[model samples]
Structures are given as C-alpha cells and as structure tokens.
Target: MTASHTPRAKSADTVSALERGLAVLRSFSEDRPQLGHAELVRLTGIPRPTVTRLVATLVGAGMLKPAPVADRFMLGPGVVSLARVFLGSLDVRGVARPYLQSLAEEVGVSTYLAVRDGMEMVIIEACRPRTSMLAARLDVGSRAPLPVSALGRAFLSAVDEPQRQQLIDSLRLQRGPEWDSVAPAMHRAIAEARDLGYCLSLGEFHREINSVSVALIGPSGEVMALNCGGAAFMFTEQRLREELAPRLRTIAQAIAHAIGGHLPALP
Candidate 1:
C-alpha cells in the first residue's frame, strides 16, 4: 500500500497520537514492506523516540510483527482483517465485479475498478480474462500514480474544478521540476475524457502497457474509475479508440445504472 493522503487536523478535538500511529502504519508499502524503527522514523518524519513507542504499541496491538530480519517489522494479520472488512463493506465493488469480469473476458484484457486515494488510484476490484496467460498483474490493493494512469485521468476528469485544481496544485508541489514534463499529457488525457467519455493511456504509465478508462460517479457523487487494458502490442491506440473504448464506456454506464447512479450517456 502507498501512503494515503491524510489531511492535517485543524480541530482541537482530534487525537494527534492516533494520527501519528496511522502514519506509522502507512509508511509500509508493497515495495518496502518491512521497516526498522530508524527507517520508519525517516519515512514518516516522526521523531525516533516517538516512532519506537508507536512501533511497540502497534506490535502489541497485532498490527505489526517482527520480521525474520533482526529488528525489522512487517504488517500483521490485524491489517489484513481490517482491509477485509473494509473491502467487504464496499457494495459498489460487488456490483461492478460481474460487469468488469465480462469486459475482461470479452476483450481478452485485464479490467479494474479503482477509487482515488490521495494522489493515486487504488484498485478495489480487478479481473483478468480466464483464458489469457498474458495480462497486467495488478490485483486488488494495487496502486497507480494519478497523473499517468488512465484510471487516474478518468478520476481527474470526473472531479469538479476546485477539487481538481487542488489535486493539480498538490501534484505540482509533489512532482517539483518534473511537473513541467508531465503536465501537458495529463491535461490532454483529462480533455479526452471530458469529450469522448473515456481516456486512453498508451504506453504512458508502463512502457509495455496500454489502457482505456471511464469514470463512474455513484449516487452520492463518489467517483470511481473503470479500466480495460493489456500489453501495449495487444491493445494499441487504434484498437483502443476504435474497439475497446466504446465497450469500456458502456460498462461504466451499466455499473452506474446498477448502483442507482445516473447513467452516463453512451457515445
């Protein structure tokens, strides 16, 4: 898991200790699953003494366990239990799975349903063609950067201006000098989504991948993204725009309709 963007508490009633403890947990990721006290302190920018105490508390609470490597820790079963519960509670995932699965099998590509988590799109549901041996290996809980992935651009297209600007500003700050190089393509993707009702990322996020995605806005205005993608050679820009894009848009509309949200007009 990537670090979630948790906003700073402005109210006096918020618990700073709990916030710090959650930050400690968020420091762990798929690429860096195990961290020692010093690593956690550096990754989270918390004081060493505070990180030590927080790690001890988390270990005691079964949220962290000692790694086989000396003095390092891995996320524990408690985290899995919490994640299970959270995933189980998502009615939209249940509603979206069959449609996504059908899209995957029909197109011989992998499909995903993702929601924005801070500056990234986090996969809440994923499906791959049953007969396909070659597809993107993303699964539930996988994260994709918001500025490059089709899933992320679809999300950006669905959000209102103020929220989108806020996210763009944050990305500018986060990306620093690299924002100049990344911004133009991101802007084009957003425009494509708004105009065509879907966005395509052709060999953008990964050199060997191509994807098309559309936004699904829930009844309460919760925005999610749906994607259909596979190897770049298999899902070329022309094939995606001429073939897969319409199907992907239709699936998004079906999902929205099933979940009692306003159905998007098909192109």
Candidate 2:
C-alpha cells in the first residue's frame, strides 16, 4: 500500500468497529507477540473494555489464541491460514521463492522482502539461513518504520523525486519537531542508497544488528526491497561495504530481472 493507494479522505461510510478490530489485530507483531490484555490496550490505545471484547471476539473466531502466560494471547492458526491465502496470491513471491532460500543460505544470514505500506515497510517474505544459530526475529507481515530501516531507505531511493519529496513532507507533518532531528540521518541514508545502489543499517533499528539492502520496481509498479541482516559481530562495516553490498545488488538485479522490473545501479 503506497501513498497513492491510500484514500484521500475517510467518509461517513467508514466502520469504526472494523477499524478497531483491525487495529487490535495489527497490534500483534514479532517483537510483541504474546501481549496481555493491558498491554494490548497500551499498544492499540483502545479502551481496556473494548480491547477485552475484541480479544474475546477474535478468540471465538480462532484468529487469536490464549498463550501459556495467564492473560496473554498469540496469533492463532486461523491467522496462518489467512497469511497463506495472501502469500499464495502473490506472483512476485512465487517467482522469488526459490531464490530467497538460496540467497539466505548463501549469505549465511536472514533475508527479507518488503514493500511500502502507507508510511511503513511491511515484510511480506522472510528466509533464514539453514545452519545459523542466530535468530533475526523479523516475521512476514511485520512492519518497520520507513525512516530508520535499510529496506525503507531503499524504497525511498527508488521512488521518483517528486513522490519522495511528498513522503518526506508528510513525515515532517506527522512527526512534528522530532522530524527535524532525524531528517539528516534519513537523507544521508537515502543518498547512500541512491549512490551505492544499496542501503546500510548499522544499529539503527536494533543495537546489535547490521544489514544491507536494495530496492526493485515490482511487477505492479510499486517499490519493493530485499535485504540481508545478521548480528553486528558477524558483519563489520568493511565487510558490509565490500562484500554484502555487492551481493545484495546482484540479488536485487536478479529478482528484478525475473519479475521484469527495473534495477538500480551502483554509481
């Protein structure tokens, strides 16, 4: 879901229940999977009573399940069914499926494929190395902030200048004064992605992790990105620049070619 796909305004026709229900569902993510009732209220900003009702409803529908923790819940098998239906529908994911496993094994790290969804990048695919003991913890359907992630920066670098400006402006408005504080770093990252044909994230999203990424034009004309990431101990700055970046660029190109999409080139 890019900016263009977002509706300009919500009308009276909108359903608040549906919105709140979805918000409740979206509150569950890789980092916060088994949240208690009070935690859900804090995460969703919905009233505790409302959260309780929604949780009960979702549990009845089998979309959520009670966890081992006394009052906590996790996504249920029903959610996996829904995810399977969505993933099975994506031709791009199907095309890149084999390559994802191969690339993850080759790099000995976790890899992800993501696309812009409103103001965030949503991971739609993930692959982990066969023998690596380290867990990257990013899961399909998880969302990350667009301004601070390698995948997001890659998408930003791939978009047209006018659209990029519009996104930056929106970020400024949404973030208020804090936008100014992070703007320089985000701009530097975007420029690095544009110049090197890839983006780097060293302890930006997580303190002990590092990654390299590049974006591709999806078959539907949306921007999509691919990345490889691991613990910082396994990836020095020199190795990320000299080894991982080139491999990431090659992977992006190969995936782009497979999907008949455009690939960015290193300056």
The clash numbers for all candidates, in the given order, read 0, 0
CA lDDT, every prediction? 0.86, 0.80
Q: Give the TM-score of each candidate.
A: 0.92, 0.80
lDDT of 2: 0.80
Whole-model lDDT for model 1 versus the true structure?
Answer: 0.86
TM-score of 1: 0.92
Which ten contiguous residues of candidate 1 have the minimum total lDDT? Answer: 1-10
- In model 2, pairs of residues that clash are none
Report the C-alpha displacement of residue 180, candidate 1, in angstroms.
1.4
lDDT of 2 by residue, 137-188 (tens): 8878877677888888889999989999998887776567688777787899
Candidate with maximal lDDT: 1
| Index of the highest-TM-score prediction | 1
Q: After superposition, how far is residue 28 of candidate 1 from its true place, in Å?
A: 1.6
